[model samples]
Target: MSIAVAVISSDTEYVTRMMSYMKGSPIYHTWRLQLYTNPERIHQLTELERMELIIVEEHLHSSLLRRLQAGGGQLDELVYTSKRGAIPIIVLAAERRELLEHELYKFQSVSALLHGMQQRYERFRSGHAKKRLVTDDRQQTIAFCSTLEQAGKTVMALHVAALLASKGYRVFYCNLERWNTSDSFLAGRVLQEQAASYSDLLYVVKSRQNASKWLAEHAAAVEEYSFYMLRPFQHEADRRGLTTEDAQRLVAAIAESGLFDHVLVDLPAGLDDWTLPLLQQCHAHYMLLLPQPGWQRKHQLAMSCVERHNAQALEELQHKRLLVLSEPYGNCQPGSSVSDLESLPYVEAWQQGDPVLLGSVHYRAAVERCIQPLLTGEKVV
Candidate 1:
């Protein structure tokens, strides 16, 4: 399952350092690295040892490119064959300089170099490679949204993702909220040196590039929770500039990537150009409602506005929408008017000032029951 990579560099010392770092890093388990101190030895890559990626030192890049263009070797055959063609070539420079599409600076940390290589390979695969075959059982996309602030939509979304992952399903949790707070609850935050910002991923999506590869490369695993999650947006403008088309394409790429069994999206309150498409694209929409007065009216107004813009989208939302009453603070009793609707029980631990409410077993069990019908494809009674 490891991705094959070959590095050709005349700098013996640099190659040694890189090999040492790879041996000590977690990436060693995911990538197979082959080092070559002589550029001519690259021809030794036979059919038995095909490389998915090739990295050339700046001094040897030109000569390698020429040889590749001239053709007639195992390397040439590997790069030109239809079945495994379009293997990516990356150039590593000694210092920061005007870089080409696949060129990277060499003096950076090994982690950064590996991250850059993964990003380049994914872009090449998404744009130049053929599409992968999708199976009959397509991945399901679920959205958690609410019109009221503090409605616990994100809390519910994370719990559902945890439950699904525990049940042996691969889950990718995405937070689309303009101001995301999921990080406060999740474990294993990406190291600052290894972090890939959401803005960079958004730019790839906006350029009409497939986001599946980006997700595959950058999605951080929440090992403590047993699910994967994309980093939240760091800036306001980046989230604000997301278009309806961008939203649709991003969701479609993740759902169709064949990487996960379920895609859980946490969305901001209200429907606009950005959120409308997402709401329409999801297989099921879980709308969290607070027990406070007038919250239902606000949701109705939001639906009415969406209807005015796209009637068909409104119809789709109505068809798949599930209303959940969130009573996290114990403001309402079980026998209240909203009792018929699916309700999340109030956990006293949260009221007792537990910061890590996401780990609450009682709350997660309630969310599991609320989402069980959708997971089983059964109608909610």
Candidate 2:
């Protein structure tokens, strides 16, 4: 009952190095790993003899892929990576901290490993003879990030909706700021639905201005049901405490919906009075920072606030999240380099800038354009 692995690599150096590394590891003893670069040779192996996992480097021939696809047996996994841009597919990795935008974009083209592995394996283990019919209530997660300004959060929410749509998940992008101040397009409906229960669940709050209007305008395709995107409150909080209750209700509704997958909370920038409670509710947090000249100071300040709020045993936060350094926008200063930021252990660093930031206005504009794609899982490039 030994598991089998197939390594298909274009780079001789990489293949040699990885094989050397694997041979020394304990996994090598339990799994039968075969190296292949020839398609005809692979066909000779029987179904049972076929490798369960295939690690193919970029530049693999199409004939090889078609053959593999036609094999019709269970393909437990496939790993595609390359030095050049030949292979453009990715499987999400929790530990993939500094992966480039180009690499991240590959996930869209090549099916996500989560879909291939976790979802499928769960079906197989459930005693289903064939593939499980994926239902609308399946669990999923959507990530959202934005700068401190009004536009950043708004745009981030829209992009998140777009991403969920792309993935065939039901999604609703709710921007509370745009709900109905009489300044925007959402001021039509005035219906009240009392006794609505809200916890960590995602639900639709009736718009006071225009219910039908907004629904018609913002209703994403059914596939977008996977997530619901919402903008963080700009005022931070009030004497009545609008954000806390609103957030609680939203979270509760999302948890109860059984239809919505993830409720991506796009929070305001800097250390706000209400940031802690919100962070506590989240399973993970993405601390977005700008790489200004004084970024070190800002980074430390942001980290301190997070530390104080999460306060776990021995200076650790139970929620394992990373600090994502976004490009600077608005009046904020430009961000520091990734290499410079990664030096900080308390933060997992990322850079969304190209050619670095030169000035305030230029950097702000750059930041705005840079993050637009990230909201919807689009690659940075």
Candidate 3:
């Protein structure tokens, strides 16, 4: 559900500027914009195209103000040509633009006007609309990390995302390893010789004065999977440049965009201050440890990570699991706290570079079942 806003101004420059700015903006993802040069043309807009707000020029607003003063009803021609209840009309006035119980805004630049409009739109929607909570609008993050590499963390992360995506929930696969694994998972689609991978997304997030517009133009997604993946950064500095806060803001921004229902992060095999923010936010944080000879060492590492961080801060996440990928025949106890799953099978799809090759594995169902509670915040469906 996208919100529509109309801008009716006789000043041709302003109308053209508004259209130009709105076209490739992230606001477009959440808003539909209509531009009208003549107030009389308002009636020509269809009901489906009707606006939630009308940003009118001063001259046009003065005319409408006089009409309203002369005892014009809500259906008057000056009233956005709306046939039903009165639509909120905001005037772009230069003098004493403060509405003081009126609907007028004073703005200098086009960007400022849009920003003011965005703020007002939020207030209006919050007050008058039956809208979902902001928290509900954001995607839930499911983080995958472990103390050692080849703990089957990446495979688990990929399959969980793939399963959710297969179920028609918009899923975004985020690889937060120090070195990007996009080429491994998304070689054909999410990479290039000098691809502007997640670095671009990060750059826009950290620096874009107009982040919504920047993301609309720059964020890259795998269309086939109905998900987005950042291109792998070429230089190590680019990867290291990100602070923990940067990672936090990036994930939050994407989730709030309402583009994905789930964000599955494949964290590298380790824990540090940099990873804690993400780990803390994950609804289901899983530490996958394969039953190799050094299993105890990895388990100790994970426990030490909990100790190193604020255990009290993480008390709420204690229910999160440490999953063991045991074989059909393994030495581990059957009733141990670690949930066991069958050994992973070999997938030849990688020879052809398919991004979702992990979805075909036999053990995906077990992975899905393990995280189903986190996905739904209740019993598995």
Candidate 4:
């Protein structure tokens, strides 16, 4: 089904227009177009490798067509535009037929002729009834927070997005670190253009910058956060770069965007200054963990952040369950294992929290195992 189509015409505009139409056709997925802007290049393709179709304009030098015929180029079809027509030539001319008959006899291989090539393609596609699949609403967003030490967040986000999209959700991969790469906002434009279709928009929030830009870009998606943190960043110096107030504004904007019915914010390890404020902003918060020795340190921070933030936010935080990211990279340090996480005392302490323990996600292939299932609503092993 993969056919190569060559358009031989000096009018790049017409060539481009024809190709554009071809690209959107049902056969488009089956064919690839190559432009032969010069006649010499056309001569380069051997007879054995001639394209499936050769579209040429009559204005092209006669020597070029002779070169094509010499190259053993037997196109599946030839569409020629000229003031005169002959057998098998698709004549495109405003002039009378008498002028074309003389020229038409010069070519013997033309099998079919159509005056308007563009309209022919349209009729061909309509006869086939090629339906364009419109994106619909079934989007879901999940927040992913990993210790800054691991840059695995991006991998996790993209994996989930692809999985959900494959399963029929209008999934978006949001990158907070680089605001410009916000997928939800980018998808928003597509959603607006096809307003009749219901396409669920899932936004992955990685950081405050992600939230900030989504607001600025006016991306609409069902709000979902991997986690929400009160203290977005720790360094007092970095705090000056963006404030809690700015984050709050972005949060409000997201809430109002109609992007998601559920928003999950992935919280970073340890409740810092941003923890309380962020918890207050979200409808839900999850104390995500990777059952390891660090749980002890993480537990203390979580408790402190939950308690100090506000009783209500703390209750909200407590009600949220422990989301154990079971998957660990296979290349973990030789000695690292799940048992290392089980021994952490903080796990037991967390069990007694306000939200209570939600159960555990055993380490597995996070993207292929965990993320794909979550996005696709399919069971993961």
lDDT by residue (tens digit), candidate 3, 246-342 = 8887777666666667777888776667776677777657766555545756677777777777676456556654344533224444454444453
Give lDDT tens digits, candidate 4, residues 81-151. 22221112222332335543212221321222222433444333232221211112422334545333332
TM-score-better candidate, 1 vs 4: 1
Best by lDDT: 1
The reply for model 2, stretches above 4 Å from the true place, is: 1-38, 43-154, 174-240, 243-245, 271-273, 313-319, 328-381
Taking all chains together, the TM-score of candidate 3 against the true structure is 0.54
| Each model's lDDT | 0.72, 0.39, 0.60, 0.39
Error of 4 at 37 (Å): 64
Residue 124 displacement in candidate 3 (angstroms): 34
Q: Lowest summed lDDT over 10 consecutive residues: which window, candidate 3? A: 126-135
For every candidate, C-alpha RMSD to the true structure in Å = 16.3, 15.0, 16.6, 19.7
Give the distance in Å from residue 137's predicted Cα in candidate 2 to where it truly belongs. Answer: 8.6
Error of 4 at 16 (Å): 53
Regions more than 4 Å wrong, model 1: 1-136, 187-193, 208-210, 304-311, 333-335, 351-354
Q: On residues 289-322, what C-alpha lDDT tens digit does candidate 2 reach at each position?
A: 5555565565666566656765552133234243
lDDT of 1: 0.72
Per-residue lDDT of 1-381 in model 1, one digit per residue for the tens? 377887889888888888788788877787887777656676643631377788888888777766655554434411433234447778898888898787899999988987898888766654442222121257778898876677888888888887777666788887788787776555435335356666767777778676778778877777667788766666678879877776677777778888898888888877776677788788778888877556656777877777788887767678678889898677665445666787786777665553463567667767877865664345532
Cα miss at 292, model 4 (Å)?
3.2
Candidate 1 versus truth, CA RMSD in Å, comes to 16.3
Positional deviation of residue 158's Cα in model 2 after best superposition, in angstroms = 3.0
